[model samples]
Target: MLIITPQELQTDRLVNQLAKTWQEHGLDLETMLKTLREVRSEYTP
Candidate 1:
């Protein structure tokens, strides 16, 4: 999985560890952190 962690991204412990792995994995972790901050702002300067 795409687990690019750090930068203070604890996101409720990664949404309770991805809600215990899976099962109707309806995601919405803050809208996937605003689409991973707009795809990391095109790779930070």
Candidate 2:
């Protein structure tokens, strides 16, 4: 069984809005993820 809470719903909406805003700024989730991985690698040793 699975259930979704009101807080989760709100967070989902917020994430959607953020993703839209990021797209408008010329960055999508994939690009952000790839950048994060690259940055982490640089610091990892």
Candidate 3:
């Protein structure tokens, strides 16, 4: 008996696509927040 639903399968595929995109672009999610904070601080009045 199959237990996985169509929605679950689609969601998994979407997550994989994002991970692949990040790798192809050489972008790191970990540094995203820190980079944003630094930019904001540098420009903050």
Candidate 4:
């Protein structure tokens, strides 16, 4: 049994839009996540 909230649905839609834009720019989800991790690590103490 699985359930999804409205907020989760909205987030999925937003991610889909972002993914499309990233693809148009020659980027990908994996690269986005890796960049996010690297940026966060830089800010962490």
> By lDDT, who's the top model here?
2
Q: Please provide, for model 1 over 1-45, each residue's C-alpha lDDT reduced to its tens digit, 9 standing for 90 to 100.
A: 788765756898886778766434665667678889999999999
Q: Model 1 clash pairs?
A: none
TM-score of 2: 0.67
Per residue, candidate 2 scores C-alpha lDDT tens digits across 1-45 of: 999675557889999999999989999999999999999999998
Model 3: per-residue lDDT, tens digit, 1-45?
879754557879997888889778887777666899999999999
Superposed by TM-score, candidate 1 places the C-alpha of residue 3 at a distance from the truth, in angstroms, of 52
Ranking by TM-score: 2, 4, 3, 1
| Residue pairs whose backbone atoms clash in candidate 2 | none
Q: How many backbone clashes does every candidate have?
A: 0, 0, 0, 0
Candidate 3: which stretches are off by over 4 Å?
Answer: 1-8, 33-45
How do all models score by TM-score?
0.22, 0.67, 0.47, 0.65
Q: Candidate 4 versus the native: TM-score?
A: 0.65
TM for candidate 3 is 0.47
Worst 10 residues of 3 by lDDT: 2-11
Clashes of 1: 0
Q: List the residue pairs that clash in candidate 4.
A: none
Instruction: Please report how far candidate 1 places residue 4 from its true position, in Å.
Output: 50
Q: What is the lDDT of every predicted structure here?
A: 0.74, 0.92, 0.82, 0.91
